[model samples]
Target: MSKKGKIISLNDFKENRKLTDPDGNPFTGVCVDYYDYEDEQKEYETRYKDGKENGLCTRWYENGQKEYETRYKDGKENGLCT
Candidate 1:
């Protein structure tokens, strides 16, 4: 049988608690959030695995400058962050 999966928006992914991966495991992917209202710029972006942060996580300032960057392993900081 061929593997199948569905791509959903970040909001849907977060709002739905029963989403799963093609393999029947918890879904995993990248999520980017933006500031609300007038400042509609990207606020941050992060990687997720099994519903938890498991890779690179980056945040930005409202002005669009990179505020910080870090790596995560199973939702925990695992490497240098700057």
Candidate 2:
């Protein structure tokens, strides 16, 4: 789906663990976060639904190695997280 609203910085979203549009609606999409050091690999990518994690969450190391992957349902960890 299209990005819901004004783009929010990764840090800001992390602090609250919730994302909202300018109108205060829950955000739904892949939230991609990157390392401070410039790199082609992203730090993480998480799928969100209604402002909470609802699908796969994947992370990587700065060297571009995949760190781990976790699944979530309604913001709570579920299924395999490896």
Candidate 3:
């Protein structure tokens, strides 16, 4: 997937510093997190804006098949999910 947001310093995020999107829209918070089970080869990832899931979230099975995918807007599911 194409990267959608600007990169900011970790320190800024840690300090709860406000940020702006590339287009200069303000964001009160942002975060991305990943979870992996190395032994099982499973993984999951999600992104957040303003303290809520506002982007793609995905999961993968241990066998390498995509387990699921969903999109979010303001922490609520907003598009196709599979």
RMSD of each: 7.1, 4.0, 7.6
What's the TM-score of each model vs. the native? 0.63, 0.75, 0.50
Candidate 2 stretches with Cα past 4 Å from truth are 1-5, 9-16, 36-39
Global CA lDDT computed for model 3: 0.58
Model 1: clashing residue pairs? Answer: none
TM-score of 2: 0.75
Clashing pairs in 3: none
lDDT of each: 0.68, 0.76, 0.58
Question: Please, what are the lDDT tens digits per residue for candidate 3 over residues 17-48?
Answer: 43355444544443433344345354766666
After TM-score superposition, the amount by which residue 26's alpha carbon in candidate 3 deviates from its true location, in angstroms, is 13
- Predicted candidate 2, C-alpha RMSD: 4.0
Identify the superior model by TM-score, candidate 2 or candidate 3: 2
Best by the lDDT measure: 2
Top candidate (TM-score): 2
Q: Sort all candidates by TM-score, best to worst.
A: 2, 1, 3
| Of candidates 3 and 1, the better by TM-score | 1
Model 2, span 9-77: residue lDDT tens: 322555457766556778788887778535545898899898888899999988889999999998888
Q: Rank the candidates by lDDT, best first.
A: 2, 1, 3
Point out the worst 10-residue segment of candidate 2 by lDDT: 1-10
